[model samples]
Target chain A: MKVLVTVKEVAEVDDEFQISGLDVDDGSLEYDLNEWDDYAVEEAVQLSEADDDVEVVTVTIGPERAEETIRMALAKGADRAVRVWDDNLADAGFLDVDTKAALLAAVAEAEAPDIVFSGVQAGDDANGATGVALAERLGFEWAAVVNDFELDRDADVASVRRELEGGVEELTDVELPAVFTIQTGINEPRYASLRGIRQAQRKELEVRTIDDVGLDESVLESPVDRTDMYEPASEGDATYWEGSPEETAGELAAFLRDEGVVSS
Target chain B: MSVLAVAEHRRGEVRDVSYELVTAGRRLADGLGGELNLLVVGGDVDGFAEDLNRDGVDTVYTVDDGEEFNHGIHAAAIERLHADLEPTALVAPNSVDGLDYAPAVAQRLDVPLVTDVIDFEVDGGGIEVTREQYGGKVETTYQVDADQYAVTVRPAEWPQAEDRGDAAVEPIDVDVGGESGTTVNGFEEVGGGDVDITEADVLVSIGRGIEEAENLPLVEELADTLGATLSSSRPIVDNEWLPKNRQVGQSGKVVTPDVYIAIGISGAVQHVAGMKGADTIVAINTDPNAPIYDIADYGIVDDLFDVVPALIEEFGGDPPEV
Candidate 1:
């Protein structure tokens, strides 16, 4: 089974972030591999380690700077990396998620992997649309927000559990060749071993342009318009209770009871 | 012209957010000078379909095929429904199931899809939706350039639509089968078997200030006395003091209870992202400078050790069930 994992690099903003036009201020922002995609790469590497025949491949769609992120995935054990970039996409600065999914699906079609794994959503957009949409565009079965996953390689079926609202879970058997969007805590992502990092420097990392992926310029057009972005309205107008801990607790209970949250 | 609201139901009951979607749908439909129509997809869901027939919707379309939410069936059913109705807008919950299928339906129809919409409006014969960005730190409003769209509304943003007698239910039969070819086996419960805090009206949540694993029962006593569920921040769950299911944060679960009593939680952005929707927030922290104070309606700048016991006593001296 050939396993393909999709990874993205996102900004890590610890301090206040400023919106500069259609994007955030990248001055203090440090771009690293997305937290969720790290888990996807780790899952693929672990699956490949279990069986020597399972070849692990990593793919991404970003600027040339993202190749460093691809290397990070390879250092954790992916056999190879593929990056998709185009002047049309970079010139637009931001591409609609649909176009990105279309381009990624095209890449997936070219690879034709038996199983694909993508982070449920990227931190930058947090739209959570790309993976499932790519699956649809590629005609692959999909499961989203998966937590506990088990694969029966012989049956080409995966018996997995998905995280749902109110802590409810759904267990399903997905027939491969399928796409699975991974949730956090599904696995503890492994770090790059010293030896693996050395091998990653020598690993195959290929780049493909939009023309190479068989997608046209029409799909690359920006569809959504960002009219404005600003800090969320400040909400700190709170009344601090100043009294003994006992008195404060009693008052708090009374307040909540009045709010009809606690029955008195 | 009409806006289609997709009602979500599970375990034979329609969710509260489904009604909220109707309320949101009504606003958009009114703006578009159209009516609101509801669509429910599931098997043995005649009751849920009837229950979804509220006053706001012009018609309730029920597609009885899958027992639970199957992504393929939802996409195919919505596609077929859109083909016939051609509603100007489609509204659904920005939920796990909705996120999985809404974009697919949007893709099939070749329309722009937007998720996690906190506010929306029909402006000058076009659509404008506002959603959070960078983990709710920023809210961006966009002008969606599309004649029709699939929008997933964030929960707890609007009040639930009041039921003013049931509307006429128009159950429609359509093939749930689609070319995507995915199957539903079954759903089982995972994580620690605890009361789902997401469903609770009141939640007593703790954080690193709870200090140690041994003192968890103190919070439990407060929760039990108030008839609230016991929940915690990621630190407590990371320390294994509580199960992952009860952890409230971006990585954990999103919950919007009526009252969230945050004890000893500093209110990190990630944690706040999950529970920011609570109607009233009462935070107990030793530091008045805690970030939790920003969003909190009330705050007690005192030690939780003293306050929790008094709160538990205020609810009367009933021993904690735990």
Candidate 2:
């Protein structure tokens, strides 16, 4: 079965950003593949390496520079890469999850892979919506925040364990050709080897646009728009301790005991 | 116009975030000069919704489908109800379950979607949603058209709504095609070395204090005494004193434990970023000026070697023989 993995490139925003536009400040701003997407690429590549018939493909939606991220995935083991950059999308200024999902869905329709993988969320947008929305658009079964899963090739099914709040986890069985969002720490992402890196530069990288993908111009419109941004509110006023070690320990224990955090 | 909030529940009990949603939703609806309607789904949701109206909600819409947080059911049902009502805004939690289907519902309606919202405001003609990225290092606010939108609310933002007398309850059945796509086989609770720090309830996390790998047993003993999982800050993990999984920092795991005891940790910004969500923070440090104390609920200005023994003694927990 063919596995398609979705990746994203995000700006490593420094503390200083352009205040007038809430954009990254002009400096040594580094652009890298999203932190969470590393796990997705690793999972897909691991699946491909373990099976003889499985092939892994990586896709992203960004400017021309995003091909570096695709190459990063290829170095990890993705067979090929696809990048979608439409002039309309570029002109939209900002993008909401739906617009990104639309572009991703177009790529998925073009690839028509048997399964898809995406990072649980992006470090920049942190929307956590694209994978699920893309799945909905593709009419594929889906699971979110998955830490572990086993694809039953014979049964045409997958059993996935999802990470939930408060440390709870649930395992479910999903039919194949499904979308699974890979959570961070799900796997140890392998660093790109020298040989792998050299080979990735020679791999297939497909470039497409909205018109090329048969997507409508309306797909460029973001339902959610960013109007303004600023710093978050500061922390609450904290009471500091000025006592000796024993006194502070005693006081802290008492406080915690009263708070019911430490019953003893 | 009305604001629709998805009342999230697990098993048969309503998650506290549901009430928080109602509280936030009530304010949003009032700002728009509209009503607040909550959607409750599941098989025995009638019981969960019975007291849901005690708060700021104007109406609680119940769908007793007998399923517990099914992604397919909620997505399909939400899409159906959204199309039927055409509410001004739809809100759910930015949780595993909430994010699973909220986007699909929004996409199905072709409404603007936002996720992981920390806070929001109703502006002149639309709503401005604020969400933190880069681990709260940067905050971005988005403006969505007021006429239609769907978004997920982050947990623990607004206080749980208090009783506001009895509001009306409305039962609505929706026809969402069977399962959206998958079926649950079962769940496996963490019991062993899977030791996902993110899943621990109480974490006895150490840092540079233990000093040497030989001193680990001290913290391990204390962890056993408190029945807490053992973890540490990035320094220990970087030094290979602890595994990466045991590290609690930005590059490590983001944990929201009920109680986090930082032993000898200085609380760097990146380190504090991962533990900021903890319900209660206890920092034990020799330096009173440590940054951890700023966010810690309780601070003990003491050396870990001196204070940990006292703590173990106070709890009457026997430390393993050194």
Candidate 3:
């Protein structure tokens, strides 16, 4: 069995930053492996470790800078990596959900993995749609926000617990050849070991363009255009407690007391 | 041209977002000078359709299907409905269940999809959606340059339409029981542990700002000093530094404590959803522009390491050394 984990290198903005135009300034943006994908990678790796002949491959749609982030996944446990990037994708103003799914669908078709895992959502775009959309494109079954699951190889079913809103977990069984969007808290993602890091340097990190992935530049054509970006106007009517930490603490203490929730 | 919004439900009751979707769909339909249609599938469709007949709703389409939400069934039903109606806009919730099927519907329909939309406008030829990115640090507007598109509205962004209207209730029986690849066994209630954060009057919620598990004692002492319960944002629970029961977020518990003190938390939209109803909110963080301050009644823009300890001292409790 093979598991393909889709990972993304998401951009996290600095505490104080500048929006140059349609995006935050490059100096203000820091890229890291998406938080949710870390869990997905761990889930795939754990599956590979427990079972024989389970090859874990990582796939990402990012530029060259993201290879560093992809390596983090490889250093943990993925057997190899595939990265799809081209000049067209970088120039593409905004990639909407459809465009992303189409690009990923092309790769999944070629790989033909038994199972696909994607983060529930990226920390940056937070569309939370790519995985299921890709499943739709591939004609595969899917489950979203999956926090726990047990795969039955003989029956070709996965008994999963999907974390719903407000403390509810929906228990579901999805057939094989499926996509499961891994949610946070599903498992503890391990830190890359020193030995694994050295091995990752020698692993196959194949880079592909749109053409290489059997996709044309037309795949980059998106109907969505990012028009404007700005800091949201502060809705805070919060009274600032200005002073040293001690003085602000005193003000908070007094306020808590005044509210009668706390007593001095 | 009309606008269609899918009503969401779980277990036996309709979700609040279903009504909010009506309110959102009404706005889009009004902008396009068209009709507003609501779609309810599975689990008390008739009752859901009746409750969804808001003041501005023009029609309610019910598909009597399974007892609970099945994404495969939903995707098939919605795809057929979209084809038959050809609505200008397909609006659904950005909730967990919505994510399960909305993307599939959009993909099958080959229409552009924008999720977690906070605000939108239909003008001239296209729709413009406003959504937050980079963890609510900034808002970006996207122009969907298409006549037909799909969007999932963020919960609680729009007020629910309460005034009842006599919308035409049409039951559309689409064949959706062909082959569902997934089966929902049942639902289990998680996060039931020792302390129920929902019952607390005061909550001192620590987030990623607590730094490490060892530093948790610092905030625990603060919660102890003020006779408050200790709760946390999702990261604390994800890290296993705190129990799942102590998590305050959309997935965990909706806490309406008298006072919610957010420490070192940037206040993601999900986290804010759980505690925004607090009578008084206080935020302590180093970042002056954290989203938590936007909703807080009082704020201290300082390092939590310094302010938390001082606050503990102000309450006449010795701060624990991390």
Candidate 4:
């Protein structure tokens, strides 16, 4: 079984973001593989480790810096890497969703992977729309927020567990050649081993362009309006509740009741 | 030509967020110079749809089937409806179920999809949607360049319209026959003893500032006395002081109530993003400069220990002693 996983380079989750005076490209910030995409790569690697015939390939779209992200995935145990590099992609603004979807669709058509994996949502834009769109373009069945999965190559079916508001739903016997968007907490992602890092340095990575994949720039959707982007305003003064446990509890209860939070 | 809104229901009750989506859809439809039609899908959900017949909705399309909610089935039903009705726009609630099906429906129809839209308006030949990004530290606006667009309205962001009217209910015979790519084998409801925070009119959320897990009894006592549902930031849930079901943040639940009281919370962007939509926000952090205060309507610069008891005394409410 072959698996194709999509990874994205995004602003680091922990970095403090600052608006660069209305200039999108002028913004200087540290970057890393999107937090959720790490889970996608992790799931793909685990599937490969479980099956001898399974091969995991990672794909991303960005400038040359994005290669580092692909390298990180390769180190984590992807069999190979693909970078869809384009200089126009930097100022590309909002078109990444459609562009990436088109790229993934093209790749899937060429390789015909048995399964495709993506993060439930990207950490940077957090759109959570691309995976389903890509799946639809490729005409594959998809399950979103999937936490558990079991593949039956013989039966051509996959059983998956999806997370809901309060519980888990066990999805039984879904057809394969499908896409699954992995939610966080689905599995604990393993650290890249030293041996894996060395092997990643020697692995083959293929770079493809829009023209090479028979994709047109006309399909890209541009942002209609550029709204003012700003940091969210802060709120409140910190109030500390203190005293003996009994005293604090008594006081807190009274406060809630008085504030009309509780029925008095 | 008008917009179509999907109302979500379970067990004969309409979810609160469904009303919010209708309110937003009504506004968008009006802005587009079109009427709004509400669509409800579920078994025996006509009662739920009837209750949502407010001013903005021109008609209600009810598709009631005994089948449990399945993503593939729902998508197919919606695809058929979209082709038949030819709505200019489609709106869904950004709940777990809505997120599961909305994108698929949009994809099946080859339309653009936007999820978690906090604010939206109809632009020239497109829809502009503003959503929180980077864990709510920054807000980004997106415009879908498609003739027909679909969006999921974030819960609690828009006010639920209360225009009372008995809308004409149109029963649509949908062929619920489809190969379900997935089946629900079982379900386990979390926090059965506690009230759902999403339905709470008032919420008091705690953070790491609570100091210790043993001290949660203080917050719990307050919640008990006030009849307020207790919620917390992700860290508190991570620390096991509260159940994961009670965590309120970007990664957890987004809540909007009449009043939201932040007790001892430092207000990380993730936590603030969830409650910033409350009508009246009150912050009770010991640090006067905590981020939670920026959006708070009332700020207490003193220690919660000093202020909370004073507030109780002022209101003449007695606390329950353990």
How accurately is candidate 3 docked according to DockQ?
0.91
lDDT tens readout by residue for model 3, A14-112: 999999989999999999999999999999999999998999999999999999999999999999999999889888857888888888888899999
Q: How would you order the candidates by DockQ, starting with the best? A: 3, 1, 2, 4
Off by over 4 Å in 1: A239-264, B178-180, B193-230, B234-241, B249-294, B298-322
Per-residue alpha-carbon lDDT of candidate 1 for residues B1-322, written as tens digits (9 for 90 to 100): 6899898988878988899988899999999999888889986667887677777878888888868898888887888889898998989888888887887788788888887898987887569889877656567888887778778898777889877745677777877654445666676554556457789889999998989888888888778778889999876875567887898976577889988989999886568868999988989998665668889999999998888887888878544432
**Candidate 3 ranges beyond 4 A from true positions:** none
Better of 2 and 4 by TM-score: 2
**Which residue pairs in candidate 1 collide?**
none
Per-residue CA lDDT of model 4 for A46-83, tens digit only, reads 88998889999887777787888888899999999877
* TM-score of every candidate relative to the true structure: 0.83, 0.80, 0.99, 0.78
Q: What's the distance in Å from true for residue B276, model 2?
A: 6.1
lDDT of 1 by residue, A134-202 (tens): 888888888888877798988988888887865578888888988899887778788898998999999
Task: Give each candidate's interface RMSD in Å.
Answer: 5.3, 6.5, 0.8, 6.9
Candidate 2 lDDT at A73 equals 93
Q: Name the runs in model 2 displaced over 4 angstroms.
A: A15-20, A26-28, A86-88, A236-264, B178-180, B191-229, B232-294, B297-322
Q: Which run of 10 residues does model 3 chain A get worst, by summed lDDT?
A: A92-101
Candidate with maximal DockQ: 3
